[model samples]
Target: MKRNVLLGIAAAALLVSAPSRATQLITEEEAKLPPPKGAVEVQQRGILRGPKVEFVSPGDAASSPLRLVLKFQSYGGAKVDPNSVKVIFLRTPNVDLTPRVKPFVQADGINMQDAELPPGEYTVRVDIKDSDGRPGTAVFTLKVAPK
Candidate 1:
């Protein structure tokens, strides 16, 4: 009887599904927006030492449902402030993606297991501040082809 009960509990645990952390980073309509006018800035400067943002995964071009991994590295002993992270889609009006990705932001980096985006070219900008209030930024463009 004891062995049967243990096996049943294990089976039940296996059957229970865990909640998903998948986030829709960009909607279909948002992906279709026109490009930003003029030149968009792509640089980072800090007083002490700014955080370094790197697009660690999914390559420069990928299909939909991208596994986006952004790594943040701080220098001069300053830690990356999770709350100070901001994500932006550099479109005509500059769409704010910070709110959508805040839940996944951390001191070390932002990891989205499944970031859904439509098939289109995307220019993303990431801004962050260190514990000392030093600002940092990163800008990159990616192409999402149909899959």
Candidate 2:
């Protein structure tokens, strides 16, 4: 009876994961890479000098798990890989290693990341480009106080 129950549980687990098995989840490291060549691209019309990126989260707020969101006021209909958006540290946060995350694009114009960070002074930089390879850059100041 025990063996049968274990087997049934294993089978059910596999069934649940089968649909997502083929789906690819983007890694934080991969998020930093440029989007692939064949991604959907719309014409670059009324292009701004650069991507107008802004932070939606508090610039002075400190939390153990920090949430970062950048909204692009104008992208010229360019496509960016949602997974490719990241909060790159100019210098290490308190932790020796940077946090890993799977970033996604929200329905709004924000690219967001939830990062578990150590308490320290931090300057984070975000670099992103449009499908046509036009680049946008933004910097933010964040201070994490140790709890």
CA-only RMSD, every prediction: 4.0, 11.5
Query: How far is 117's C-alpha from truth in model 2 (Å)?
Result: 1.3
Find the number of clashing residue pairs for candidate 2. Answer: 1
lDDT by residue for model 1 (19-111), tens: 555678999888878888764546545453678898887886788788888999999889999999999999877899999999889999998
What is the C-alpha local distance difference test score of each model? 0.85, 0.51
Report how far residue 22 has shifted in candidate 2, in Å.
25
TM-score of each: 0.79, 0.50
- Assess candidate 1 and give its TM-score to the true structure: 0.79
For 39-134, candidate 2 gives per-residue lDDT tens digits of: 231334565655555767646756655555567543567665444444455432222112232324542345334545556555556655556666
In terms of TM-score, the best-performing candidate is 1
- Which predicted model would earn the best lDDT? 1
Per-structure clash totals for the candidates: 0, 1
